[model samples]
Target: MTDIASFRLLQPLSRRALLGSAAAAGALIVLHPFAARAQANQAHLRIMETTDIHVNVMPYDYYADKPNDTMGLARTASIIGAIRAEAGNSMLIDNGDLLQGNPMGDYMAYEKGMKEGDLHPVMKAMNLLGYDAGTLGNHEFNYGLDFMFNVMQGANYPVVCANLTRGQLASDPKNDDLFFKPFIIIEKTIRDGTGAESPVKVGFIGFVPPPIMVWDAKNLEGKAMTRDIVEAARAWIPAMKEAGADIVIALSHSGIDAAAHTDRMENASLHLAGVDGIDAIFTGHQHLVFPGPKTWDGMAGVDPVRGTLMGKPAVMGGFWGSHMGLIDLLLEKDGKSWKIADFTTEARPIYHRNEDRKIVADVASDTRVEDSVKAEHEATLAYVRTPVGKTSAPLYSYFALVADDPSVQIVSNAQTWYIREMLRETEYRDYPILSAAAPFKAGGRGGADYYTDVAAGAIAIKNVADLYLYPNTVQAVLVTGAEVKDWLEMSAGMFNQVEPGASDAALLNADFPSYNYDVIDGVTYRIDLSQPAMFDKEGQRVSDGEGRIIDLMFDGKPIDPEQRFVVATNNYRAGGGGKFPGIAGDKVIFAAPDTNRDVIVRYIIDQGTINPSADGNWSFAPLKDTSVVFSSGPKGRQYVGDIKGVAIEPAGDGADGFALYRVKL
Candidate 1:
């Protein structure tokens, strides 16, 4: 069963505040003395995990410039001490994606470079929390190797990864020149039921998604390579066993997918769990949770209620410090080795939504974690608050999935403008330039409060960063009209097929990531929800039926299959991210050095007072007597009247505090 446990620390922060600023230099707070004893031959071990923290040291949102209850290491840190007091032996670990995500990460990389002896703010916070170990996630390679290496030097704990190689692979996966230590054997003292103390060796092996080769190709094309998650596990688990590890745990940065295992698959946690010698697993990189009601409902070999994958204990903490994954294990002595006799897993939240749809923090912020990075947090606030330009219309992504949106339109406009100017003096200047942009925050796994909402006023660096998330550089690709049509067909998989007369059928495919729902702005088309999707979520052709994209037009004429066009996109897509059709390294015509966010900032500055109204380049085709339902943040209700060419009304409350809306097509 899902074993979520919550215990309040009485006046955790208030005591520190009462002591005033003098407490900053005082001794660190300890929840309980580590003097508890367990029964002989059996022990209780609690494994705590924090994944995808993404540089959120304080309980604040840099984009909105306000305190947020949902995400922050400080909030998660409040319960760490209390959680440790419950078990005789405990280990706190991080499951990677620690380096980059929010504006603080951007500020550190761009504004404040990581020089020698300079510790990263996130690493400092994790060190203060006394993390035992951590692994590498795919996002760790985002800022390039030198910057990543500089940041890794600050980590106080052992960071291990079995799959990533520096230059080339050796003859065997075990012999590969690993970028980090393959696995570490952590020695610990365990207390048995008889109060007898003994030594136990816990081994942790780490693995990342193999697609980093494609996602960050610019930084990792020739300099690095990766082994498959399952392949690497099969090779290294034996070595860890021979190294005298009594119990083995796999820190898989990949997600859980029950699909048949293939080499280089992105979500291979289920397959990795089946490998021998792995006693338990910690999963992340999908920003999801195990033992949760939704997300993993009917997948084979995945028991959400029991929190098991292939019958092995597993947990995936929600991203951005929203949840802390805990796996409680009862270890029994079996001859020379320790076996997992029983276990209970949970993804505990730092905050909970009340009946009134407001967030109520379960635990107060841990003052020690907040104080560790106070200087960097303050500097990051100053950096993001610097004004860049102004916008005439509000930019939000509430209806981005259902209609053309201003938030995405602004990014598309900025990309098109930047690329047009970059290629104006080049040989390919006359080609028709189209920009493809997607909504990075559309309230999927990020929860209801994750959408981008910028008021129409003076915009700052944070607002521009919100307009275009990620640090991808601008890239222009040359593609034929046929490839463009297939591209749109691939993106159309975001919506689920609706029957012509069906009422309130689910509109969106929850598994489809919002980042892959690319909306090409220069072409106009209608998404026919009645038709079957030509491409699946993996960008593979799954049907031989009519495509969902209909009446495709460019310049008021039917697009020709032979006509070649220049598509302005980010390096992630041009380098084969999301497996888009006919878009890869060979098609890239111009790769600019400037980042996409920087280009947006430049565009806003050039326009001075910019207008970010969506031009309505795409829409849903009419299906008589059909109404589909979807959910967004409750704040979307106010902007429902601003939507064009569609009739949307409040349906009711949705699960997990989202407000459902019905759209008539």
Candidate 2:
């Protein structure tokens, strides 16, 4: 952690009083001249940010299915309080996705609808903390737009989005505002070292990913429209500068996109740096913390890529309020205006990463905040505990991707079935149906108990949440057979290219996130681990790759490029999530209001009894008599009975008692 005193403020205490206090304490006092000089000449602006909160307000991760001490905005509140104590001026902002993720959000949306004047539990908590501004995340529309606006009524702060637009209001005879105020200018007075007061104006502009319109089209259709984020920034930043903002900070809900590994713009911070008049940026949506200052390629004067935008400090606090982003700007008075002199950005985590390799909360949550939402939290627990469906067989994803597994197949089947019905009235009703479902129960970030373990019995609301944690609605996209092959090629990027002779550890990209690994189950194909990934993270082809997808067979026949197929997938993926080729939001033929979890529950109930068996539609290219070693959570231990052509050996504990299985395929 950086020393707090480096960015010192002018002492409000007088020299004589300081001397007297020092004499009273019998201690020698020394003051840095630089602090005094900076205090007299510079104004400091502090920005606090929260992103990807996913409504874990109480420090528990329902998705991890564990009591995580590291996360929760309540934990973040402690850091906010501390930062405020040290700074003369500060602003608190959230970057989006505050609406869903945990049972708290689900309970609120389903069990307790928002009353006319009633406040949302999370918004209520944020209001007490005095948030300056926030933007909408994609998940905000999960419960529907009306619910979002209803909950927003309780917020004390402005909910800003510069790209979203509303239609004309008939009663008002004028169009409602699209997005939010392009920017907000805030004026604050600060005391100097000599007991003099200085006035400063700070401007904030908010941006959300335009893709939300497609991701949540079911809820957003004909209500509002979205524009590209970068394009929107280009149009709005100039207007903010003209509006007399001494410092302009972008509250960007979009993550960075960089094609080159060398360029820092791969993260949103760096990308936003290219925008003019954006003096500082507080970025989120990627759920990553800026390690420290970094500079991007072809950028000069402390590029925002390195935590400084146009030489102004910027920071992205990690998600779930795990860390509070802090940027301290040293400004010099140029005539009547305060110009930035020097600045630095830092993210402080509420829970310190301890020597024991565990994150220990540095401070306790504000009792008042917890007390405010205690009732809602309890109500949510009760709601999630209720049984929603019954399953005759266990719904586990133990062999999901490794073999033809039924857990994922059931999900895929349900999604396709749902889409087919939904499109019955649409123009694309005759399209051949295909469903794309990934192994949500895969043992990765989800710990030992994270896998679905409802064993041939009752499936409760908790089980449903476990099966489908994200609040993604169902969507069907139309794509040709060739595009399907490309989509699978992109999905293959999830795996590390295994060299013929490399060890298992060498066959995985340690940095590659597990969520991006979407296993396409409806198609019969083989993943050639020996081949390099066709596309990179940005969806750019690694080579002039014509066909990374081999055998290209659908139902035991070569796929025709012109043959159109409607692939069923969750809203996230269908709306440019994995950056798969030819699967943009525009290609969507049908959108279902039901989430994948709900569909799964409905399917299980309708079936009465399920075999939970995979029909072996997809498999790996001949393992060539070679053995592959993999690890899975203990919850997967019970479902290892069906893996074929593999020698399964128990290889002791890996991550959180995730039993390692060495299989010779």
Candidate 3:
């Protein structure tokens, strides 16, 4: 009943260079004009989506300072250009997260401040690509309204989002004071399967995660507000249909996770699809792809092979311009209004890791776009390269998980320093303070080289970028001692179950991301691997398990279960980016506008030379005659002697250029 598949060959197109510079005042390159109706009743409408780009426009990784094939819009431009050529009618649209994420974005905001008439590099690229419409994502507000509003002013295409509003009344589209237009109507000609052509009104309404109010509370507390995604969609979708929209597409800046933890859940793309009058949905925010075996195989309601959500076609282009999402519709003229007869969705990635672990370039970067932003890109490179401070010892995360690591320790120190200063002048000064940090560069899907290994001196902006990996603002969450134990239990879920006296048992859970493995710096605890994890990855309790986190203590005594503690964390975690219990929007007591990376930079500058030490806060409970096998970057071999609390040695090489090590529990 659905053609939500690309059974046909996904034509890999060479990215032809656009001759003109991408930075010029480029006119919108309209693809088949609506007034120029095609010659058939059954017309084709191909919708192209670039989701979660986060402002990476060029084919480069700023953190790595290398030619990256998997990221950047310039590379996807080739795929989009090829797809446009193959189709008779098509429109390019963005699925949000366009204005933030990259260090280049921070460079532009912090070093190269925006003026009244400045166009952001990513906005220019989207305009040059002839994007018909776009939406806003959660990261958009990270830089605040003035910066975002200034950037949005330069966009030639219409930007629409139904959820974000200035005030309570969202009834009248014109007078509602909505951040962007609620929906835009585009009249386009479609070539039906019957070889007939007609003009059909395709409407696009945008929705952002409702948690933005909490995530960007500093920027959005008074002036702006957000309604729940589903509620907002239901309210506007009916109006879109009544407004004579022939077919409607939901540009959801959300993800496909079916679990709704709250009434205003973060990832509600699936729920948004169930709303009436929405023909298709483009989802993002998780930075993951759909219609692939890895993410979609055997999921409920999702037809992975066909790329359908509840029988409706959906696609999520990978983040950082890694992939281009395409949805082709066969619209048959049902009298006056056109109805979708058939559709297929596919997410085409720019590069793939072959069996040999080599990253092959699937498409070349578009020079035209790169040329336009060439000056800005170079400026950003210099911006990141400028030295900030020095480190006494080399900072690396190769042994971060198995033992205390300076890489994670430095972040915790910076957070503790910043949070303590803030707490000193407040009523919360009486409560004890703790800092939580996770090693972001633990070398997973980004490859073995995707780890933090800063040499013992001269920390620059790029090094900070590698260390933190996000521009997340700092926040302090007030939690009871009981909740703190539960929180650590959730983070301890990163390890695999181990048996006593088991030889070479696997230690790490490959499915658990290193970023989710938060280590609390102020508390002494033991993670007993023999017991089951109390919480699953989604923060759902699998079982009321016993003592994974054992002997948790603070101030040289057992932690009082009833005592209150203020734990420092980033906005992403505090606002429920990770499904951790006891840390939600409501738990946040203090919100600092400074990003965690910036705090690290400031800490290093103030200290002159940072000495990162783990303070021996957390360790595993002893299990005699048992060893566990774990994998890390091959680079970990050099630091085996320095790791404490566990007897460790190199076992051998692991899959994908990693090293295997055995650690005595």
Q: How high is the CA lDDT of each candidate model?
A: 0.84, 0.67, 0.80
Candidate 3 achieves a global lDDT of 0.80
Q: Write the per-residue lDDT of candidate 1 for residues 142-165, one digit (tens) a residue.
A: 788888889989988899999999
Clashing pairs in 2: 164-179, 165-178, 256-267, 256-268, 294-306, 304-308
Candidate 2 lDDT tens digits, 1-665: 22323211212223111112233243223332323455665655567788888777887655334666678787676445446545555677887888876678877887788877888889867877878878877678888988888888887888777767775322321133674665688776755544467887778877766656555667877887665555666777777777778878788876554432231121344556677777777777666675344323454434544476445566778777777787777666788777777766777776666687766555456555677788887787776666555665677776554666666766777777677666765678887788787777676666666565567766665676556767677888889988888888887776666656444433345455555666565567777776788888878888565544677777678988889998889888887887777678688765554567767655655666555556667666655556566767765666666554334555567766777775554
Please state every model's RMSD to the true fold in angstroms. 10.6, 9.1, 8.4
- Candidate closer to the true structure by lDDT (higher is better), 2 or 3: 3
Candidate 2, which segments miss by more than 4 Å at Cα?
Answer: 1-37, 168-176, 230-243, 258-272, 291-305, 352-360, 390-392, 397-403, 410-452, 464-519, 525-552, 559-613, 618-665
TM-score of 1: 0.68
Q: The CA-based lDDT of model 2 is what?
A: 0.67
Q: Give a tens-digit lDDT track for model 3, residues 1-665.
A: 01112111223223322323341123223333221343356677889999988779988877657777778888777556556755667888988887777768878777788888998888777666788889998888988999989998998889999888897755553345788888999987666555556688999999888878766776887889887788777778888888999999999988886554357777788878788889999998877788777566665667878998888999998888888898888776778888887788888777878899988876566666788789899998897787767887888898888777888999999999988876775689888899989999888788877878888878786788678887577989999999889889999888888989999999989899889899988888988999998898999989775759999999989999999999999988887767987778789887663569768876877888888755668888899888999888888788788776767899998998988999887
Task: Tell me, by lDDT, which candidate is best.
Answer: 1
Residue ranges of candidate 1 with Cα displaced over 4 Å: 1-38, 388-408, 413-458, 464-520, 525-552, 559-665
Report the number of the highest-TM-score candidate. Answer: 3
